[model samples]
Target chain A: MTKTKKDVKLQQPKNQKYAGKAMTKGRYIRSQMKRNWVGYVMVAPFLIMFIAFTVVPVVLSILLSFTSFNMLQVPEWKGLDNYVQLFLADDLFITAFSNTMLFAITTGPASFILAFIVAWFINELSPRLRAFVTLIFYAPSISGTAYLVWGIFFKGDIYGYVNGWLLKMGMISEPIVFFKDVNYIVPLCIVVAIWTSLGTTFLSNIAGLQGVDRSLYEAGAIDGVKNRWQEAWYITLPSMRSILLFGAVLAITGAFGFGAIVDNLCGNPSTDYVAWTLQHHLVEYMGTRFEYGYASAIAVVLFAIMMGANALVQKFLSKVGE
Target chain B: MAVKKLRVRGHRVVLNRSKGGDVGITVMLILLGALMFLPMWYLLIESVKPLGERNITPPLLYVMKPTAQNFIDLFSNINSTWVPISRYFFNTIIISVAATFGCLVFGSLTAYALSKIKFPGRVAMFKMIQWSLMISSTITGITNFFIFIWLDWLNTYWISIIPVWASTLGLYLMKQFIDANISDEMIEAARIDGAGELRIYWQIVMPLVKPAWLTLLVTTFQQVWNAGASGYVWSEQLKTFNSAIATISGVSAGAASAGSVVMMSVPIIIFIINQSKIVETMASSGMKD
Candidate 1:
C-alpha cells in the first residue's frame, strides 16, 4: 500500500508541472498582446497617415516620372523622354540648377557662421539676457510678418526704406534697383535668407554650445590655453561638433529646398542669372502647364542633388563626430 | 610666503578683468540684434502711415501723422471678398487651433509611450521620426495633395490639420524631454496602483511634459497659421491672408506693393506680441541634442 501511494504522488507532481508550464505560457502571450495592443492602436493613426500621404506619394512620384501625364490627360508611359528633355533641352533646368547651387553655397555657409556667432553671444550672457536676445532673433523666423516688413525695406525706389536709408547715409547717390536688377536679386535674397535662417538652428547651436563639458574648458585652461579663441577651437568646437553638423545640414537643405520666398519675391520669368531652378520649373510645369511627367523628372533630379548634398553632410558630420 | 600670496592675488585680478575680445563680442551682438530688428521696425512704422505718406523718400522712421486707414482698408477689403475676410480669419483660427492641439495631444501621447512603454519596434519608430525630420515638406507636398484629393477631403480642414498633426519634430522634442525628465519608476508605480495607460498619461506624463507641449503648441501654431500650400489647395473659398495678398498683388506691380505691405504687417504684429515666447521655445529646442 505504501509503494502504490508513493508512485501516485510522483505521477501527480509530474502532471502538475506540465499544466503549470502551459498556463504561464498562455498568460504571457495574453498579457503581452493586451499591453501592446493599445500601443499599436495609438501609433496606427500616424502610421496610416504617413503611409497614405508621404510613402505613397514618393512611390507614385517615381512612377509618374516615367509617364507623360498632364492633369488633363491620363499618364502615358513615355519611358526616358521626360528625363531626356529635362537634361538635354531644358535651359531653365540648367539655369535653376546653377541658381540653386549658388544660393546653397553662399547662403548655407554664411547663415551657419552668422548663427554660430549669434548663438555664442547669446549663450555667454546671463540667463535672463540670453532668453531675451534669443527671442529677438528667433521671432522673425516663426512670424510670417518679417517678410512683409522686409518687403518695404527692400523696395527698389527711394521710397523704399533700405534705399532711403542708404541715400541718407550717402552710401549711394540714387536708389539701388534691388529687385529689378539681376545682379542684386540673388544677394538680396541671400540677405533675407540669412535673416530668417535664425530660426530653431540658432537656438540649437546655443544649446549645443551649452552642453559642452566644463571640464574640457577647465582642462584646456590648465594646459595654458590663454584666450577664448583657443578655448573655442580646442574644446567648444570639438564638443559641439554634432550640433554644428546638424545645424549645417539644416542650413544646406533649407537653402537648396528654398522655393516660396524666391517664388514670391522674384516672380516667374526669372529675371537674370540662373534664378529659374528645378523647383521653379517643376512648379511651373505642374501647376501652370499641368505637365506632371516633366515636373516629376525635374523633381527627381532635384531630389538626387539634395540626397547627394545630404550624404556629403552626413559624411562630414561623422568625421567631425569622431 | 607674503610675496607668493601677493603674486597669486595679482594673477586673479588680471583674470577677472574684461578682455578686449569680450568687448568686441558685446558690440557685435548688439549690432546683429539691431540689424535683425530693423526690418520689422520699418514695417510697423509704415503700416500706420497714410497711403500718400507711404511713398516718402527715405521712408519715415516715425509716422508724423499716424493713421488707421491701412487697417481699415484691409478690414473693408477683406469684408468685400466673395468669401468674407471673416471666414478666412475663422478658418485660419480653426485650422491653426486644431493643428496645434492635435500635435500637443498626439505628440505628447506618442512621446510618453515611446519613453515609458518598453515594446518591440519603439526604437524603429523613433528612428523613423528622425528620418522624417531630415526630409523637406516640398518632397511630400504633391503627394499629400493627391492623397487629400483621393479621399475627397480636398478643401476641408482635415487636409490641413491631419498632415501637420504628425509633426516629426514635435514628436522628437517630446521624446527628448520625456527621456531627460520623466522617471520610469513613477510610471510603473502608477500602473501598479491600477492606473490605466491613458490615465497615467493624462495625470502624470502630461503635467511633466507641459513645457515641451507648450513649445510644440507654439511652434505648430506658427507653422499652421502661416501654412501656404494646403491653404491654397483645399479651400479656394477660404483664402489665407498670404493667398489673398498674393492674388491682389500678383495682378500688377503697383497692387503687389500695397498688397505686400498689408499682407506682411499682419504677421509682424503677431510676432511682436509673441516674440518672447517664440525665442524661448526656439532656444530651448535648439539647445537640445
Candidate 2:
C-alpha cells in the first residue's frame, strides 16, 4: 500500500540535479523539519489516538497470543499451547477455520469481480442514470440488518418468500430449511454475503471509474483500440488499477473476516456451526468463553491468513498493465 | 438512446447494432437492482403487514393491508421495564454522532499534515497507518475490551465512542483528496497573508474538502451505527438500538422486519440525501493523473 508513493520520490532526484549548490541530505531534512512543526502538530491528535488504540493493541494481541490470560489474573506465558489447542484440540475452531476459508475462496473473488463489472457497467450509463444505478447496487450494503430480511425471504417454513413462491408454483412440496439445514446453509449465506459485499470497495471502484482520464479513451481510439472491451482492457483497467487493487485488499480482508453477515443472516454459530467463521470462533473465545489468550491466537491465525492473501493480491496487482 | 455509440476522438463507433441491446442492458440493470433492493423493499412492506399475513402460506409480495401495528408492537412489546427503545436510540445517536464528529476532525487533521506538509517522518507515519490496515480489529478486540475493563469503562458509552476516533480509512481518503486538490502553494499563499495553520485548515482546507469529508461522514456514520450493541456497551440503557433490534427481531417475523426498518431508516435516508454528493466526491478520492 505504501509503495504507491515510490514513483513520486523517484522524480525528485531530477529536480535536485538542477540546483546550483546542493546541501547535504541531513541538513536538507533538518531544514524541512524546522518548517513543518505545524504539520506534526496537525497530525498529533489522530496519531496519538491511533498509536494508543491500534498500534498498542496489535502488539498486545500478538503478545497475548503467546500467553494464557483470563482477564482476572496476570497472564501466564503458555508458548505454543494456545495454538496447539486451537489447531488440534478445538473442533469448533477447525469448523470455523474451514468455513472461513470456504467463504473467502467463494465470496472474495466473486464479489471483487462482481463489484468491478457492476461499476464498469454503471460507468457506461448517463450521469443521472449512473448515479441511480450505483445507489441501487450500494443500497444493500448500507441497509443495516437488511440481510436479516433475507431470513424472512428464506425462512424455513411456508411463511418464507422463496418457499412460498416455490410451493405455489409447485416446484417443491416442502419448504427448504435454508438456514437450518447444513446443505443450504453455506450456499444461502454466500448469496447474502455477495449481496452485501458491494460495500466500500464498490464505492471506491465507482470513484475509480469516474477518475479515469477522458483523454485516455481518445488516445486509445487513435491507437486502434477497436472496441469497448479492448478499450476497457487496454485503458480503463490499467488506469484504475490502484483502486482495483485497493478494492481487492478490502475484499480479501472482508472475505476472511466474514462473520457479521453470517451472524446476522444465519444464527450466530449458525446451525451446527455450518456457517461459523474464524471471526465467530474468535468471538466465541473472546466474548463468550473469556479465553483471551486462545482467542488472541485464533485472531493471530486469521491475521496471518489475511496478510498472506494481501501479499498475493499485491503481487498480482503489481502485474496489472504489464 | 443517443445512437448507442462511443464518440472517441471524433471516431464515432456504434457499439450496438440495434436499440434492443440498450434495452437489454437496461433491463438487466433493473433486474439486478431489484435483486439488490428486494430485501429492503420486503422489509418496508413486511414491517407494516398485519401479523397474520407475515407468516401465512404463499407470502404476499405486496401487502393487501398495511398497518403500523408491528412498529407499534415493536416499541410496546419490549419485556424490559427499565430500558425503553428510545433510550437505545439515544445512546446510539450520541455515540455515533460524537464518534463520527471526532473521526472526521482528527482524521482530516492527520491527513492534511501527511498529504500537504513536508514534515520528517510523515512517510513513516503514513506507512504505519497503512500497516495497521492489514490487522483486523478482531485481533485487537479482546485487548480493547481488556483495556476498557482496566480503565473501568466497560459499561460506559465512552468505551463505544472514544477508541474509534482514529479512522485509518478516513485518513487515507482525506490524504488522497488533499494531495490531489489542496496544493502547498494555496497554504503558502494563506500563510503569506498572516494566516496560521489552524486558521488555514479551518478556513481554506475545510471548504475545499467538504465533499471528501461528507463521504467520510456517511461511511463513518454507517460503521458506528451498525456497530450498535456489538461493541463494549453492556448496560441495558447504554446498548445501541441495533443490538436491541437484533434481540427484538428474533421475536417474530413482523417484529424482525420492524426492527430492520428502525435500524436501517436513518443511514438509508442519509445516503439517499447525500448520494449524489458522495458520488461526486468519490471522483476526487483517489490519486489523480
Candidate 3:
C-alpha cells in the first residue's frame, strides 16, 4: 500500500502540471474572446442605428440628388441638371441663400452677446438668487408653452395682442400686419429666435463663468481692479473662452436649423423672404409637389453648406485656442 | 485725529455712492427679465381673454373675467369626427416617453462601458461620439425619412422613437457624470464578488448616475414634446396637439378660434408649473460642467 501511494503522488504532480498549462491557455483565449465579444455587443445597437438611420440615409440622399425621382415613380438618373437649375434657374434658391446668410450673421452674434451679458449679471448675484434668475431666463427656451403664447402675442390682426396694445397706446393708428408683411418677416423671426435662444447658452455661460478661479479675481482686485467690470475683463472672459466657443458653435448650428418657427409663422414658402432654405425647398417638394429628385438636390446642397460651415467654425475655434 | 476722521468719513461716502450703482444694476436686470417674459405673458393672458375682449387697448394685463369656455371648446372640437385629438395626445405621450427612456437606458449603458472598461479603441470610440455632435440630426432627417420608407416604417411609432434613441449628447453627459462621481474600485469589488459587468452596471453604477440620468430625461422629454417633424412623417394616425390646433384654428373662422386658444395654451400652462424646477436643475447641472 505504501509503494502504491508513493507512485500515485509522483504521477499526480506531473498530471497536475499538464492540466494547469492547458487550462491557462484555454482561459487566455476565452477571456480575449469575451472582451471583444462584450465590447462589440455593447456597441452593436448604436452601430446598427447609426448605419441604418444616419449613414445609409446620407448616402441615399446624395444618390437621390443625382436622380429625378418623385414619390409616385421610380428614380431616374438625371446628371447635373438639378444642381445647374438650383444655381442658375431657381430664383427662390438665391433668396434663400441670402436670407440664410442674413439670419446667420444677425442671430449668431446677437444671441451670443445677449447670453453673455445675462450670464455676467447672474454671476454677480447671490447663489440662490442666481439660480432663480437663471431658471426664469431659461424657462422660455425649454417650454413649448412659451411658443404657444408667443404665437398669440404676435398675431397679425388688429385684435392680435401686439397690434391692439400699440393701437390703444396711440403708437400706431392702424394695426401693423407683422406676419403678412415681407419687411417685418425676418426681423420678427429674429426677435422670436432671440427669445427662445436665451435659455441654453445663458445657462452654459453662467456655468462657464463659475469655473473661473476665485483666486484670479482676488489677484485682480489686489492690483486695483476696483469693480466687477474690470474683474470680468481680466479674469472671467479669459477663463470662459472654451465655453464661449462651444456656445458659438451651438448658436451657428441653431441658426442653420431654423425651420419650425419660420414654418409656423409664415404659412407658405413663397411669402417667406428666405424661401429657398434647404428645409423649405425639401418640405415644399415633399409635401405639395412631390418632386423628390429636386428636393434631394436641394438637401445635398444644404448638407454641403452645413458641413462647410461646421469646418469653418472648427477652424476658427482651433485658431482661437492657439 | 480730526483730519483722519474726516478722511475715513469721505471714504464711507464714496462707498455709499456705489450703492446707487447697485440699484441701477438691479433695475437694468429687472427690465431685461421683463422683456424676456413679456411676449410669453402676453400670450397666456390673451389666451384666457374672451374673443370680443381680446382687442382691448393697452391690452388686459390681467384677465378681467376668465372663462373656462376656451378649454371646453378645445375638448369638444378635438372630440369631433374630423380630428382625433385624443389619439394624437396618446401617440405623443408614447413616443416621447419611450424615446426619453430609451435615451437614458442606452446612453447610460454605453457610458458605463466607456467609463469603466479599459479596452483597445476606447478613445477612438469616445472621439466618434464627440464628432457625431457636429452632424446635425436635421441634415440626417431627410435621409432618415427615406430610410424609414424603405424599412416600411413610415406612419409608424418606430420612426419617431428609434432615430432619437442614440443621442450623443446624452451619452456625453452620462460619461461626464460617471467620470466625476463613480469610482473604479466599486466595479472591481463587484467583479471580485463574481458579479457580471451587466449586473454591476444595473445594480451599482446606475443609482450613482441619477442626476445625469434625470437631466437627460428632462432634456429629452422637452425635445420630444416639441417634436413636430418625426411624428408628422411616421404616424398618419397621429396629429400633434400643436398641429391640430394650428389646423383647426387656421381653418375655422369664428367659434374655433377660442378652441384653438385652449389647445395652444395647454402646453404653456403645463410649462409654467414645472418651469421653476426644470430651470433650476438645468442651471445647477449646467454649472457643474
Candidate 4:
C-alpha cells in the first residue's frame, strides 16, 4: 500500500497529496496524520456516532447471542444454547426462517429483475416522461403507508377493490380474507413486498441506466450488436457492474427486512405466522419475548444469511456479461 | 458532456432495433407501471373520496365528489388526542430536521476528509463502513436497545433522533460523490490560499457537492419523517406525526386513509423536487467492493 502510494506521489510530485520527508512508512503515516489532524477532527463526530450505533451494536449482538440476558438481569453465558434452541428446540424460529428464506428468494430476485428490466425499458423515453415513470414506479417504496393501500385493496369485504371486482366479474361468491387467509397471506405479502421493493435498488438502477455512456452503444453498433437485449447483456450490465452490485446489496438488505410491510398489511404475527420473517422474529424476541440472547441468536443467523447472500450475489454479479 | 460534437437528443441508436420490440417494451413498461401504480392511485382516490363514497360497492376507482373533509376530520381527531396534535408535529419536525441536518453536516465533514485528505486510518475506517453496509440495522435491534438504555436515552427524543444521525448510508453516498466530482488539487489550492479546512469544507467543497448533501438530506428526512412506533419513546407527547396518525387511523377509516396520504405526500414531493440531484448523487453510488 505504502509503495504504490509513494510511487504515485513520485510520478506526480506536482500536486503531492502526501509529501513525506523520506521517512519510514509508519513515520510517514504519523507525519501525515499530524499534518491532517483536522481530517480526524472532521471525521470524529460521525465515526463516534457510527461506531456507537452501527459497529458497537453488531459486536454486542454477537457477544450477547452466546449469553442469556434480559434487560433487568446480568447476561449469563451459555455458549451455543441459543443456536441449539433456535435450530433444534424452537419450531417458530424454523417457521420464521423458512418464511424469511421464502420471502428473500422470491422478493429479492423479483425486485432486482423488475427494477432492472423496468429501468431499461423506460430508459429510452424523453427525460420528462422518464422521471414521471420513475415517480410512478419508485413512489410506493418511499411512501411510508403506501403499501397499506394493498390492505384496503385486499380488505376482506365486498367493498374491497379486489373482492368488489371479483364479485362484479362473478369470479368468487364472497370476498376472500386476503390478509388473514393462510393461503393468500404469503402470495399477498410477496406482491405487496414487491410493490414496495422498488426502493434504493430501483433508484440506483435507474440512475445507473441513465449514467451508462452513450458511446458504449455507438461502439456496440459498430461491433454489430443486434438488439437491445444483446446491448444490455454485453455493454450496459458490464459497464454498470458496480451499480449492479450496489443494487444487489440493497436488494438483499431490503428482502430480509420485510417485517414492517407484513406487519402493516397483514398484522404482526400474521395469521398462523404465514408471513413471519426473521425481522419480525428478531423484534418479537427482543421486545415481547425479552429473550435478548435468543433474539441476538436470531439476529446472528439473519446477519449470516444476509451477508452470505450478499457474498453470493457479488460472486454471481461478477459473472454478468461473461 | 464533453461538448465535442453537436448531437441530437437520445443519441446512440442501437443496431437493428425493431419496432415490434419497441412496442413490446412500451407495453410492458405501461402494464407494469400501471400495476405498480394502481394501489397508490387507489390511496389518493380514497383520500379524496367523501365518507359516503368511501364505502361504495367495489369502491369507485375515481371519486364522484372530492372533499377535504377527511383531512379536516383527521386533523380534528389529531387535535383531540391525549397530547396536543402540535406536540406530535413538533416531535416529528424536530427529530427529522435535527437528524437530517446532523447527518448531512457530520457525514459530509467525514466525506470531505476521506475523499480529499490523505490521513492515516482513513482506509480502514471506510472499509469498516463498507462492510457495515452488508448488515442491515435490523440485525442490531437488540443491541441498539441496550445501548439506548446504557446511554440513558430510552423514552427520550434523543433515542429516536441520535441513532439516525449515524447512518452510514448518507456518509457513504456523500464520500462517493465527493470522490467522483471533487479533486484533490482543488482542496490543495484552497489550503495554499490560506483557507482553513473548515472554511474550505463549508464554502468550497459543500457548495460544489450540493447534490450529494441534498440527496442525503432528502433521503434522511424521508426516513425520519415516516418513523412510527419507536420502542424508545413511550410518552404520547414525544411521538411523531406518523405515530399520531396511526392512533387517528383507529377511529375513522376515511381519516386514516387521509392521514396516510398526508404522511406519504411529504417524502414523495421532496423526492420529486430533488429527483435530478438525487439521481446525480446516485450515479456515483456504485463502489467496486
Candidate 5:
C-alpha cells in the first residue's frame, strides 16, 4: 500500500501535465461512473419498464397515426387522410370539437379558481377543521363512481329529483329531459365536471398554501400591504409558483380530456353530441370502430392542444409577480 | 408570560376587526362543504332505501325505513352468469395493492438515484422522464393495447400493474422531498463507515423519507383504486371493481349505490387514517418562499 501510494503521488503531476486539459471531463465522468454504479442499478428496473410501456407506446402511437390500420388488417399508408377527414368531413367530429371547447373553457378556469379559493379558505382554519373540510370537498372527485349518482338526480323522467321537484312546485307542466335534451346536456354535464374537478389540484393548492412561509405575511404587512388580497397577490402567488404551475397543467389537461364525466352523466354519443369530447371520439373509433389510425390521429391532436396549453400556462405563470 | 401577554394584546386590534369576517367565512365554508357532500350523502341514503320507497314520486331526503337489502342483494343476488361480487372485490384489492407497492418501491428507487447519486447521464435521464409526462396515457392508449397483446399481457393482472410501475408524479415528488429533507452530512458519514451504497439507501435514506413515501402511497393507492374501466382487460373473471360498478349500475340504481359504497370505502378509510401524514408531506416538499 505504501509503495503504491508513493508511486501514485510521483506519477500524478506528470499525468496531469500530459493529459489534464483533454481528459478532465472524460475522467470526471469515468470516475463518477466507477463510484456511482449503484445508482444505475437502482434505477434500472423502473427505467426498463417505463421505456417498454410508456416510451415505446408513445412512439408507436405517433407512427400509427399516419397509417390506416383497422385491427383486423394490415396498416396501409394514409398520409394525412385521417386528419383531413377529422377536420373537414366528419360532422360528428366537428360537433365533438365544439362541445369539447365549450366544456373545457367553462370548467377549466372555473375549477382552477374555485380550487385555489377553497384551498386558501381552508388554510386559514384550524388544522383539524381544515383537514375535515378538505376531505369533504375532495371526496367526490376520488370516489370513482360517486358522481354517477347525478344521473339519477338529473334523470329525464318524473322520478328524477330535479324534474320531480320542479313539477311538484308548479314550475313547469312537463318534465325536462335533462340528459336527453340538447339544451340541458351541456350545462348539466358542465355542472358535474365542476363538481368532480375539486380533486388533486385542490389538494396540491392546499399543500402549497400551507408551505408558504408565515413570516412573509408579517413582512408584507410591515412593507405596507394592508389587506388579504394584497398579501395573497404579492406573497402567496410568487412563493408557490411551481405548485401553481402544476395545478394549471393538471386543470388544463383534465378539462381537455373531460370525457368520463360526460360519458357517465350523459350518455356516450350524447344527445346530438352535446357533451361529446375528443376523448369520446377517440374511444369511439378505437374501442367500438377498431379504427386505430383515426384514434391515433385524434390523440396527436389532443397532444398538440395540451402542449400548446401548457406553454401558454408557463408564459402566464412567468408574468405572475410582475 | 408578561411579554407573551403584551404580544397577544398587540394583535387584539387586528383580531377584533376580523371577528365578524371570520364567522361569515366559516358559515360560507360550511355551506359549501354541505353542497360538496350532498351527492355522497344522497348515495348513502339511496342505497339504504328499499326498492319500494326508491320510486316515491319525490325522493325522500331521509330514508323512512333504512334496510341493508341492497347490500345483501349485492353479494347474494345471482342473476348474472359472470363472476361473483366477491371475486370482483378480490381482484380489485389485489391489483390495487400490487400496483401501489410496485410504484412506491421502484419510483422511490429511481427518484433517489436522480436526486442524490451523481452519475453520467443523470440529467438526460431526468429530462426524459419529465418529457414523458407531456405524452400522457390517453395518447398511448391504443398502442399500449397492441403492445400488451404482443407481450401476452392482455387479460392479465400484469397488464394493469406493470404499465404503472414507474410513476412520473411519484418520482418528481420524491426528488423534491429528498432534496429538501435529506442531509448530506449523514450520508457522507454513513459512507465513511464503509456502508455499501445500497445499504445506506435502504437503512438511512428510506427511513428518513417516510413522509414522502407515505404521500406516494396515498396517491398511488387512490389512483389504482379509482382507475376507470379500460379496454385492456377483457375477461369477465379479470374485470376490476370499476367494471363491476358499471355492470351493477347497469342492473339497478340501488345495486350501483351499494357497489360504489363498497368500492370507495377502502381508499377513504386509508386516507382518513393517514390524513395528517399526506398533508404534512405535501407541506414539507419545499414549495416555500
Candidate 6:
C-alpha cells in the first residue's frame, strides 16, 4: 500500500538537476521537512495510531497468512501450504468462496444501481421533501440491528409475520422456514441486504446528483437534449463520475461484508453450510479454533477478491456515460 | 394540464419529463420506499405490543392495548440488574464520545495538513490512508487481538475506543471535503497575517470545515455507538449498551424488541437533525481518482 508513491518520489534525480549533485533524495526530503515540519506534527497523532492499529495489522495478517501460528508457539514459516490447503484441500473453503462470490456478485451491483436509480428519482424533489424520502430508504440500513427485525418478520415458525399471514389467508399449511431453508436463506438475506444497502452510497449518489450544476442541464436542454433520459445520460452521470466510483467502493465493501447478517439471522456455520461464507470461515479458524495460519489464509483470499472486484468495477465505472 | 410547457424549477429547465414517466417513477419510489420502511415500522409496533399481542397467530399490526409495559418490563428484566441499567448507556456514551472526538480532531488536522500544506509526502500519506479503505477491517481481526494483548489493552475501554479512532473512514471524507471546499488562498492569507499553523487551524480552517467535522462526528459516533463484544473487554462494567442489549435479547424477547427500537432511534434521530448538513458534507466527499 505504501510502496508505489515512495518509489516514484525517490527516483527524483530531477532534484539533482535543479540543486546540484548535493541534492540527494534524503536531503531534498529534509529540506521539505524543514519547511513543513508543522504539517508532520499536526498529522502525527492520527498517523501514529492509524499505523499501529490499522496498517501494521493488515501487513502482519498478510505476512502471517504465509506462516503457521496456533497461538501456542512462535509463528513458523509455511510457504504456500496454507493457500494450497485452502484452495485445493479444504472443502469448506470452496463452499465459502463460492457462496461469498454469489452473495457479493448479487448484492453489490444490485445495490449500487438501486442506490443510483432511487437517488436519481428523488433528486427532483425539493430539498425538504428529498431529505425525508431519502431517510425512508436510508434509515433501514443505518438503524443498527434494526435489520434483525427481518428475523421476527420472517421467523421460521407459523407465528412469523409471513407465516402467520399465509396461514390466516389459507395460502399455506405450515410456516415456511425463511432463514433456515437453504433455498430461502440466500435469497431472503440478499433481499434484506439490498434493503439496508441503500445507505452511505445512496446518500452520496443523491448528493452527487444534486451537486451536478443546474446550469449544465440548462445548457444541455438548449443544445437539443430532448428528454429527462438524455439529460441524465449527457449531463448527470458523467458529471458525478468520481462520486459514482466512491459509491461503488462502498457497495463492494458492504456486499463482501455480508456475513454478520447471515450469522445473526441464520446461525453461523449455517445449516448444511449453505449460508456459510468466508467471513464465518475466518471466525471459525481465527476466533474459535485459534488456528491463525488458516484464518489468515481465508482473510487474505477474501481481501484479494474484494480488491479485485473493486478494480474491475472501477474499470467498468470509468465507462459510465460513454 | 400544460403537457407540452417548458417547466423550470427555480433556474434549471426540468427537461422533457413525460407525465406517465413522472407518475411511474414516483409510484416505483413509493412502492420500494414502503418495502424499505415496513420492517422498521413493524419492529416499532412489536416493541410496543403487549405480551399477549406479541404471540398472536397473525400478530396485531396496531397495538390494541397500548402501554409502556413492554418498555418497563424490558428495563426490569435485564440481567444482573444490580449494575443499574443506566450504566450500560454510560459506558457507551463515554466510549463513543471520546473515540469520536479524538477521531474528529486527529482526522481534521491530518486532513488539513494533507489538503492545504506543502509537505513532501503529503500526497503519498493521504493515498496510503485512502487505500486503507479498499480492504475490510475484519481481515485485521486476528492481528488486532494479539496487538490488544501486547498493548495490555485487553479487558479495558481502550480496547473499544482506540480501534475506532484508528479507522480511516472519517479521514478519507474529511480530506476530500477539505480539498474541494477549503481554498489555498485563504490559508495563505491567514499565514500572511502572521498566523502560525496551529493558530490558523484553530481559527481559520476549523471554522471553515464545520460541516465536514459534523459529518465526521455523526458518522464516527454512529459506528462506535454500535460497538459490541470484541472478544476483548470482558469486564462487565466496561461492556457497552450493545453487548448488554445483545445479552438481553437472548433472555427476554420483549426487552430485545425495545432494545432494537432504542438502538435504531439514536442514529436515526441524529441523522434527521443533521440530514441537510450531511448532504452538504457529502457534496464535497467526491474523489477525483
Which pairs of residues collide in candidate 3?
A145-B268, B155-B234
TM-score of chain A of 2: 0.90
Tens-digit lDDT string for candidate 6 (A230-254)? 8888789888776787778888888
lDDT for each residue of candidate 5 in B1-289, tens digit (9 for 90 to 100): 2222112345532311256666777888888888888888888887887988978876777798899988877765544637876787788888988998999888888888887788899899988876666666778888988888899987788987887786676776666556655766666666656678778778877766665577568767888888846567788888776777666655667877887887778787887777787656545544321
Query: Count of backbone clashes for each model?
Result: 10, 0, 2, 0, 0, 0
Local distance difference test values of all predictions, in order: 0.68, 0.79, 0.66, 0.81, 0.78, 0.80
User: Which is the leading candidate under lDDT?
Assistant: 4
Report the Cα lDDT for residue B214, model 6. Answer: 69
Between candidates 1 and 2, the one scoring higher on lDDT is: 2
- What's the true lDDT of residue A103 in model 1? 84
Categorize the docking of model 3: acceptable
| Reference-based lDDT, residue A254, model 1 | 81
Residues B164-224 of candidate 2 have per-residue lDDT tens digits of 7876877877776676556687776666556788888888887776666776787788888
The better-scoring model by lDDT among 3 and 5 is 5
Instruction: Please give, for residues A1-322, the per-residue lDDT of candidate 1 as tens digits.
Output: 1234555555455345446465676666565556567676666776676667666777788788899886667889999998888778988788888888988888887888888888887767876687678767876686554565566677778888789989999999988777667887778777888888876567566555655545566566656666787777667776766566557667876888866666656666647643665667777887788887777777777777777776787677666423
Which digits, one per residue and each the tens of the lDDT, describe model 6 over residues B6-71?
567776677777898899999999898888888988888888887787788887678888767767
Clash pairs, model 4 backbone: none
Indicate whether candidate 2 or candidate 3 has the larger DockQ: 2
Docking class of 6: acceptable
Per TM-score, the best of the predicted structures is 6
Return the lDDT, model 2, position A226: 63
Error of 6 at B44 (Å): 1.0
lDDT (10s digit) by residue, model 4, range A137-179: 9888886777888888889999898999999999999889888
What interface RMSD does every candidate have? 9.3, 5.9, 10.1, 5.4, 5.9, 6.6
B-chain TM-scores per prediction: 0.76, 0.83, 0.75, 0.84, 0.81, 0.84
Worst 10 residues of 5 chain B by lDDT: B1-10
